[model samples]
Target: MVSSSSAPGSALPGSSSPIAGPAPLSLCAREPRVPADRLVAEMVPPPRFDSVRFGTYLPDPNQPSQSEAVGVLEGFAAGLDGAPASGARRGFLGFGRSKAPKAPAGPRGVYLDGGYGVGKTHLLASLWHATPADPSRKAFGTFVELTNLVGALGFQQTVQTLSGHRLLCIDEFELDDPGDTVLVSTLLRRLVEAGVALAATSNTLPGKLGEGRFASADFLREIQGLSAHFRAVRIDGEDYRHRGLPEAPAPYSDEQVTRVAETAEGASLDSFPDLLDHLARVHPSRYGALTDGLTAVCLTGVRAVPDQSTALRLVVLADRLYDREIPVLASGLPFDRLFGEEMLRGGYRKKYFRAISRLTALARDAGRLVDA
Candidate 1:
């Protein structure tokens, strides 16, 4: 999620710089101990949603889509001011003694669920951006980032920190891990009980969470129960990823691929598998360690990434590389063919789509460098 001020160069690591040398430590050499506040801040920067107003969302004529979802979100946002006192209870007399009153219940939140690349993140970001500013009153981030924060900060402390926010807007809300499911369930329950309004976007509906992951019945039940407290809205349409896009070109020529390979070999590039292993072992903050003193990544034998977790990690890697403008060279499959049939329908489909898109752009950039 780090932002770069300029695009990275296409030169090899040690080609231009006299003092360029191997990194002192590898990404897996040590664990990253990022502070909780810093992690949250880095992960939840204000989204680029200035142009994403509700009026701009065009819905599909054939299906119930973004328009319906937008209406529900607007209503929910409007009702926030009239929300009842949370946890309020009427005073009661017991043994000729009167008990103090508690706060009343508040308005429920909204959950926007849809397929991959349906602008779920866009709408969520728009909602957060349109809300009037109040310091420490709103929180917006992807579900993965929040869960990672919870792991780093501990459950209770993370809950306390987030509960203070008046609204919580989460994107890509899907449960693949049992521990994360439990932690998120508990955290959401606490937030709702404390009267924090919520707005979230997800590819999977709450009831269908962890469908193929062999999730426990109790965990599924918890998700379903928590879902009951939110207004569920389904945004239906074709994936926006494929809309108005030109046809993809053929795979890179042998010479084009060889050019990148030679550059990497000259710079002694790291393998993608090694990077993936390191990513599995450390926090995402540690991923920066992979790019240290490195100019290019050459990945081969990438015929098909079958596992959903691996595909998701690849998505993150692609994002980091794209943000840094790093050139990547890969072989063994075309960009569009890297994903298997099953993976296209898996929970990580959106991530896979993103990875393919970014990788294609990077490949094109690399091809341009070779052509030049």
Candidate 2:
């Protein structure tokens, strides 16, 4: 947590005190509130991908599936027709009546199933760009952000808000909890029924979601119902972040990180453990807001997370920071060592691997600051 004496724009406890220039901010002290309207408005792609389009995506020349996914998704987007999905409507007699033109014969959406850093997000966002609807008629966000929106505005309100969209692109679809599985499953079903198209990218195939994370058998119907809505596209490739690229640089020294934090404009400094404690205090839905204005993140005494809960929270924070393209400078254990062997071997290992990949990329970006 933030020290009691640390005022806004003041030096955080872990940073060197009495340093010159602007004081480093502390993420531990921030508690941001995102209104329902802002949440709805910000559902578009994050800044890192704000301008990504189909032409901007570079599929691996060696991976045919990657290229194939592009063509398939493009065709899927063209089929959207920029209108609500054709479904049953109420008749004058107060009975359900099917629309004259039948809905398309096959799946109502496309699902990109692949490993981390394979450009799944790129393709998902490109599809969003390619869809023939106005920005207000389409939405793009991670599965967690979508669920968070639902949490903020009740379920019915969420459905009403999204039901009119021509396309909804969900990135990083998760199936870690049974409740989320049911919630999102029901939500997607309602949206699909409402004539709204869908698309998603995930590390796991739709059919295999929630398999190892929970007692999936208990919710097999919901899982299968979710899977049935999309045509699963399998994308196979090594992590693009590290492929043909040099490994991430070593951690910076504490003094180096603190110096950069104190001198760099818009930098926030915090001890890694204290930041984790602060994350616990704030809801995960607001993690994006917590990182609102940070240009860089500096951490000291970085070490392995103590448990699965803390590790999971760290994953969400890592994702939010990555989405905002914030550089992370840290001392102590490297990001690859932040999770234990047991955690890496567990059901949520994919999330952990993606977090490591993203953090490593950010760490590499932060190296330039030290070099300067």
lDDT of each: 0.58, 0.78
The candidate that achieves the highest TM-score relative to the unseen native structure: 2
Candidates in order, TM-scores: namely 0.68, 0.87
Instruction: Please provide, for model 2 over 1-372, each residue's C-alpha lDDT reduced to its tens digit, 9 standing for 90 to 100.
Output: 223333444555556665554567888878777788988999988888989987888888999988888888887776665344434321211112334243344666777777678888988888888887889989999889998999999999999999878788888767556678678878988877767778876544233434222222323344566565567787767788988888767788899999998778878888999999989998888888888878899999899999999999999999999988999999988999999999877777878888999999999999888888
Instruction: List candidate 2 segments past 4 Å from native.
Output: 1-21, 84-105, 205-222
lDDT of 1 by residue, 51-151 (tens): 67666766766766567888877656655543433332211111112232332233356677666556666677667755544535678776777787787
TM-score for candidate 2, residues paired by index: 0.87
Minimum summed lDDT over a 10-residue window in model 2 is located at: 88-97
